[model samples]
Target chain A: MKVAILGMGSVGKGVASVLSSKDLGVMVTGVADSRSGLIDPDGINIGALLATKRSTGLCGSAGITAMDVVRGAPYDILIEVTPTDAVSGEPALTHIRTALTMGRHVVTSNKGPIVHALHALRSLAASKGTSIRYEATVAGAIPIMHTLADGLAGNEVLALYGVLNGTCNYILTRMAAEGLTYEQALLEAREMGYAEADPTYDVKGIDAAIKLVILANTIWGTSSCLKDVEVRGIDLVTLDALQLAEDQGCTIRLIAEADPSNRILRVSPRILRSRHPLVTEGTLNAITLVTDLAGEITLMGKGAGSVETASAIIGDLLAIRSRYGRCD
Target chain B: MKLEMRDAPGQLVAALKPISDLGGNIIAVIHQRDPGSRSEVLGVQIVLDLPQDRLSDLTDLIRSQGVNILRVNEERLLCTRAVIMIGHLIHTDLGGTVDAIDRTGFAEVTGLTIRMPAIDQRSSARFTIRSVNREHMEDAIAILRTVAREKGLLMIEPMGVSQ
Candidate 1:
């Protein structure tokens, strides 16, 4: 299978590196980014790209560029890795829509497109007889989407909720354990590289909203628009609130949920007592899904990072390849 | 409406039947699942699908039976605003940061989150608020920024707009 990478950002590079390391039948054909990219239909050198990027942040940035190669050959899969707008999540929406319209299967880690344009994008994919697999969008490395879409495919989901944002969970967990105030926890989190230079989406619950939309759309088979979700950030949590919750044997966690009835979607920080796995610590993500047949099933693991998320995207690619092979 | 009838079985139904008899739809019923459940103050959030002209008569008719309408408030979904807060949002004072914004009457911090790898590491938080108006939203952000500065934390607004 020939794959075309849209951006050579952190996640994109991780995808390319994983594909190259496994020596799977998959080959990267074209790479594109804001900067110029190289395209070799015969298969580009993934190792060479990594080396260039390691030396200088610029080289191997994207697998393809605005400029096309002399041959003008198209790729089977177009991975869109554009930057996400934390607020409206726009341009990413435009890029993914265009790619799907062009009849290319898209796999992205960009939450902007998946969260805001789920209905339109899925409809376009169906119209074009292609799929948009985004395993790495939420829970970074964990296959939360696949768990709901495939593993629990046999059950009717009653309620789906979780601590989807690693950043928030980390801050809360720290506050719970060390009695650190929110500011102290945040300072610690920034030094650890779990947050962006500007960590708006992760902190405000917008990041969790993106993941929630993906789950709601996959489970309900309805368009879960971003605007519909009831969102609450942890910004209101105070040392007193944390102390109060702790005194009651509870801790605060930024949670996201999808409720089909009343068109309700909730994302906020709520106090959880002991025995709730969500109250646990540091960069860990846990999801609880209430189903008619399965009851409540919970899974937890590393929620972010390059290698972990990249591995997820690659795993998704392998699943596609395994099922459809050259046909896909 | 104030209905001072004995809190008995189906008393609500008996009281409500009069409203229906007069072609009045019960917009809300504020009764304790246990009238003794939480001190006789049963609160229900509701909306009526009646024209303003009929509302007065409906209230008058129900009040004649002694059913108390403690307080009637409009039920509407609040507007939400996105805010990016920077500082030791995760470490130094995340809860305080949220509190500063939440305390602002015009806006309430509906969402607050921080990200980082370790507790010892520094991090920032993004805040989402629901307010009645745009000015309320700005005021809330200003409060957060002020608190952040006091804590010796950097305040970054993630909208990508320089503050």
Candidate 2:
């Protein structure tokens, strides 16, 4: 399949490298960074593109922009990996819309577009007779969307509960394991590259809330936005509270839950037992899908990283190829 | 098809010769003989890949051998639906209710979960039924409704519309 990648970040670079290394029957026709893009109808040289990015810090030269790749590039699937703008859901949203309007399938890892405009974009893709897959959006490399949409096809999902955000989970784990203060744990997390310099979204629960909204929309076909969630992050979770919970054979975890029957969605730091399925340390994520036929099925895996996220992107690409044959 | 034949030498071979003579490729043959039963009949179930035109001839040949045909299933269940039933499930014979759906040939109960708080109080169960298509699903629901009414139970349909 001829594919175009928009966003030459870690995830994008990882996807390009995987496509180059593996014979997944896919060709990278175009690639873009924030400022520039590279497009060739006959499939761009992935090795040369990576070398160019490494040497000059950009994927394309002058006169080539992301808009050009979206509109003019000859490809069947558009892979949108742009940085998320939670408030606007911009550039990524528009790029996806344009690609679907032009009758092309879309695979994305960006959460903003899906969280904000999932219903609208899904309707557009359906009307256009295409598909949009974002397996890496919620929990990186988890394949939760595929599990719900395809793996459990005949089963009805009654509820979903998960530990989706890695940054907060890392901070909480550190504070509990080391008996360190919240500030010290956050500092250690930043030093370890787990927490961003500006960790407002992760610490204040906005990130997990966004993920919950995406899960709700995908699983239940609900048009739930970020504002609909009752958000409560790990900002106030203290070492004292952790110790207290530990004393009670429990640990604190930022849990995101969605109950479609009651239309309830929330993310909060809850006290979980030591043996609970959702309790995991470090940058790991776990989700339990309570379904009618499958009972409670729990899946756990790495939630983020360049190579891991690329694994999910490649999975989406293969799923598309299996559904629709490789582009001629 | 499933069948029963008299337990004797060559009885098992006799049950399958008709299918082969009618140009059917045998996929599987399950033969179990119960010597303890008074009738001494052996249970035999066979799966065959036979042409559509020869099905009648094959059945005629099998019946001519005095073999009793138990079931003739031609369609496979492809769609699924889940419903909740409440009100004294165990007391009303939940197993019989499940058996009624499973015997429909087009629908079968695939999953079941029961919740009971007390011995004599009302109980609830969530059961999933898979069928061949939408029409079969409706028929299954109608059967469940009839069973529920006869047993003084209530059926709670799923909230989301069928996709």
Candidate 3:
């Protein structure tokens, strides 16, 4: 399968590196970073593009643009792994829309478009006889979308609870394990590169809420807006709170939950037992989905990282390839 | 519950009928007829499982059946949820917060443990709220949420069904 990947950040590089190493009958015909774009009718040299990206910080010719690659590249799938703009399903949304309108399959790790234009995008993909798969938009490496859509195909999901934010989880883990104050732990997270400079999106619970919106929309087919989520950040959580939770063999975690039956969509700091399945440590993410046939199943893994996110995106690609079958 | 009904043959049937009418399950009924012990009344001990809300209705129906109820032990407020509130607890009128649930009749804040780092700093408290059933518990938490919002407090409810 020929694929075009946008966003040559860590995720893009990881995908390129993996495809270069694995002879999985996949070819990268096009790639684009923020500043440059590359296209080749045959397969692009993954090693050369990565080396140029590493040395010069530009993935390809600056004369080319992202839409140029999206519209002009000859590929079976468009991998839209751009940066997320939760407020506006950004340039990625337009890119995905254009690709689907062109009757091309899409695989993306972008949450902005997924959160804003999922219903519309899915309908457009269906109308064009193509589909968009976004496994990396939620928990980074959990393969949650495939698990819900394929592995547990017939089971009805009753409810979902997740620790979807890695930065907050890291802060909380450090706070509880080392008795660091919220501020101190947040600083530690920033130093360790787990948290961004602003950290508002992660610590303020907006990031997790966005991922929850994506998961909820996919599983229940409910076009839930981000505003529908009742979000609470961990910014105000104090040492005393964690201490009190630990007093009773429990800890605090920023939890995102969706219960369609209860009409609940929430992301907040919740008291969880220390041994609970959702009480994941460090930058790990965990999701517990309650289903009728399978009961409750918890999936946990790296929520964010180069290879971790690439794993989710590649899974989506392979799923589309398998469903449609190999052409070569 | 233990009951004293007249030793009439059909009196026992009258009392037992109301138990099932209220959608109660009769787990066991120790109605032993001591051949020589009963002077004029039959002392029968009955155990049953029923919704706590219908305890009053069951008591009323059994009394109208001419059975004197000596003792009734129905556990009310059997369901409890623990929530943590972190904010200016005292400044926000913590008494009002607890009173909000306690006044609901069905739900009450039964336990509390506070950790005040300093007088000027914010305080954190874990409150155990008890209610009769799941619906009542939900209502109680909703009230706390409203109160927490008004007080500018962060209310952290327990997650998972195990709590």
Tell me, by lDDT, which candidate is best. Answer: 3
| TM-score between candidate 2 and the true structure | 0.67
Please write out the lDDT profile of model 3 over residues A130-247, one tens digit for every residue: 9999999988999899899888999999999999999999999999999999999999999999999999999999999999999999999998998999999999999889989999
Q: Please tell me which predicted candidate would have the highest DockQ against the true structure.
A: 3
Interface RMSD of each: 10.6, 16.1, 0.5
Q: Which digits, one per residue and each the tens of the lDDT, describe model 2 over residues B32-69?
A: 66667777777899977676678888888888888888
In TM-score terms, which candidate is top? 3
Model 2 achieves a DockQ score of 0.01
lDDT of 1 by residue, B1-163 (tens): 4334455566566557655666644666644355345444333333444433566676666567666665544422245655444445555657777777667665677766655535665554546677654455656656765786688664433221111
Judging by lDDT, tell me the better candidate of 1 and 3: 3
lDDT of 2 at A287: 93
- Per-residue error for B152 in candidate 2, Å, reads 50
Off by over 4 Å in 1: A60-73, A86-90, B1-163
Per-model RMSD to reference: 12.0, 15.3, 4.9
Candidates by DockQ, descending order: 3, 1, 2
User: lDDT: which is higher, 1 or 2?
Assistant: 2
Q: Docking category for candidate 3?
A: medium
TM-score, chain A, candidate 1: 0.91
CAPRI-style class, candidate 2: incorrect
